[model samples]
Target chain A: MRDIHTSAITDAVKKLCMEANWNLEPDMLRAFDRALGRERSAAGKQVLQTLKDNAELARTKRIPYCQDTGMVVCFVELGQDVHVTGGGLYDAINAGVSEGYKEGYLRASIVRSPFDRVNTGDNTPAVIHVDVGPGAEMKIMVMAKGGGCENRSKYKMHTPADAAGAKDFIVECVKTAGPDACPPLVLGVGIGGTFEKSAILSKKALFREIGSPNPDPALDAMEKELLEQANRLGIGPQGYGGDTTAFAIHILTYPCHITSLPVAVTIECHAHRHKEATL
Target chain B: MSVTTANDGIKDLSTPLSDQDVASLKAGDRVRITGVIYTARDAAHGRLAPLIEKGEKLPIDVRGQIIYYTGPSPARPGDVIGAVGPTTASRMDRFTPALLRLGLKGTIGKGYRGDAVKAALREHQAIYFGAIGGAGAVLSRFVKKAEVVAYEDLGTEAIRRLEVENFPAIVLYDCHGGDLYQEGQKVYAREGA
Candidate 1:
């Protein structure tokens, strides 16, 4: 088995965290450019322009794009044939988060516990999702998920026959989210899995590029349709009202039990910060 | 980047907003705010609400001042403030009316306010302003100075009194009960419908 040093993972996570906060991904930038041209509301266009200017300034100034540096979420795909050396995988990941937030001058947004509510100081204890994959390389995908949009994400368990209701539910979710989730959102939809699985799938769907199509033609069609319907609500950019409410909708589906049909919607603001690295 | 100058009929407002200032504002009017403002988010507001209930003097004066619902990032070596943007305003809805009743004239935040908060604004002749939600880096440039005024232990959630110049914002909810979120949706959705 090939051995991967945990320090390498730590270093990668640290750099990725800082990089993700400072720069909006290229795909997101392109999506914003497209939205600027397509937006109908004058205020909406101005909002989009401000966002573009913010991204540019953040990159040049080496500052965070938003004040909420976000809770770090890392998706680690570990190879079955590879072994992690130096320490436990999670410990290394947490160490990376601590260094990243501290050195990068990012905000420490995490609390020790949800109920007790004290700052963790270093933004540690990243939410890590691990999948064992074939091959020898380990891939880590990091996302800085802001709390505003995360608060708006929803999960619902629907009956098997309520397939048509899923679309309506997504539209309603965006409607209710309105300006709170930061309009011109990117929606990640997870369908056909169990409760927790569906939630995870929805988050994973967000890792895809903004304009990329799903591998499954049916899922891609659903994404396109949902996106069109969401923009029709006229929530617009920053909810000032316009035709370009949502930039993109992504769907990831999985097989599930006969009695359960779970759907989860994970909404992301325009500051969609994510980066990936393989080792 | 320099602060965005007020243009296109956008008015310039200063702190210690008067009733006339609140009255002149409308739901959709863009404005550049200058002068002293306070910052408080969920935790600081939680503490302030209880203090107000117990009839204790607050650490910072709320008289006719605007409170920005933001938790800014740590400033770099030479910067006055780090990227600062408005957080979701609805999270602070429950504690808003108490502050409004105490002569808090305005709030700067993102997203929709609840009906209770809107009613309180109308009752108290207050207003709510919306900053560009995710445009923190751009917005932070307008903050000329920032100093922690209270709740230092709360870290980023601590209340900061900021001196700002030409900070851009739009009137989301005016004292007259004009709601920008509702009005904007009505105007744009009609065409689509």
Candidate 2:
């Protein structure tokens, strides 16, 4: 069995938080370049160029790419053979987030209570999801999920009989998001699962690198089709209207109960920042 | 790092904006704003409404000023400000009409405004400018200086007085009832439909 110290987890999480907020991953940077090359509207092209420049500045200066540094969402893959030491896993993660936000000067956007509307000040208690696995290695993926796009995420439970209708409904989410959710968007779609499971799957699907094809050939085709339909809506970049509405569409599916065909779409903005580390 | 400036026919205007400045702009016009503007978002608006309702004095005189619906990230040491960009404007719709009635000239944000806001803008001869939604780092370059003018406890949502130079934005809504989002969509969406 392998023993991992809680301090290490905390350090890793802190570094991931700061890095994700300040840097745009290579996949996202490439996606922007592709969008710039193909975008038909002058406004859309300009917006893409501006966004690329912003990413460079954020990285070099170690400043957040967007003011809404976002509420942290973490996915942890824990191996059964590894023994955690020093503290609870979640406590360590939260401590990391607090330190990262403070030391990095990232915005503390979390509210202690939704109704009271008070800022938590530290940006703590990340939305963490963990899964146990076979090996000794622990993998953690961090996402600074923005409130604007998260507010636009949608889930729908469709009758299994209406399988043909799924694509249209998925595209509808993009239309409804329009300019507000910040396009060009990266759509993470979850198909087939229990209601809550589908939502989680959708959020997890966003971690996939852009320009990468879905492993499942069937889902890959559906993702391509959905992307074409979404862009056709002309929401464009920041809804100024253009041919490039979304950078990519990612779909994750699971076998569900025969009665339900649950689906969820997690809308992500152009500033799609995520990072991962394995220890 | 490059920033948006008044060039290639992009009109440049200063604040506190004048009546002629409002009248000259139309939907879809790209313009750069220079001089002072204020930042306020959901929490700030929530605080503003009650004072306006009770007829109490506001912390800042909002007349002829543009209120950007933004909550900027904290500035790093020695930096003018951090990544500061527009947030969703529609969330501020309820508080907007009151501000416009009080002689607020414009708002900088992203997304569509409600019908009430459209009507209010027409009635008051105000404007709505849409900044690039996620370009906060780039946008911050235009802000020559920033200082929190009120509600320091509110942190990022505090009202900040900003001195900007050639901050670029598109006129999404104008006093003359033109809507850039609608018109722009109609042009590109026709092919898709």
DockQ of each: 0.67, 0.70
Instruction: Give the winner by DockQ.
Output: 2
A272 in model 2: Cα distance from truth in Å? 0.4
User: Model 1 misses residue B58 by how many Å?
Assistant: 0.5
Candidate 1 local distance difference test against the native: 0.91
Cα lDDT of model 2 by residue, B105-151, tens digit: 99999998899999999999899999999899899899999999999
Tens digits of per-residue lDDT for model 2, A35-140: 9988889888889999999999999999999988999999999999999999999999999999999999999999998899888998987999999989999999
How much is the lDDT of residue B79 in candidate 2? Answer: 91
lDDT of 1 at B72: 95
Docking class of 2: medium
- Scanning candidate 1 chain A in windows of ten residues, the lowest lDDT window is A164-173
Give the Å shift of residue B175 in candidate 1.
0.6
Tens digits of lDDT, candidate 1, A117-203: 989999888999999989999999999999999999998988888998887888888888889888889888899878899999888
Off by over 4 Å in 2: B1-7, B190-193
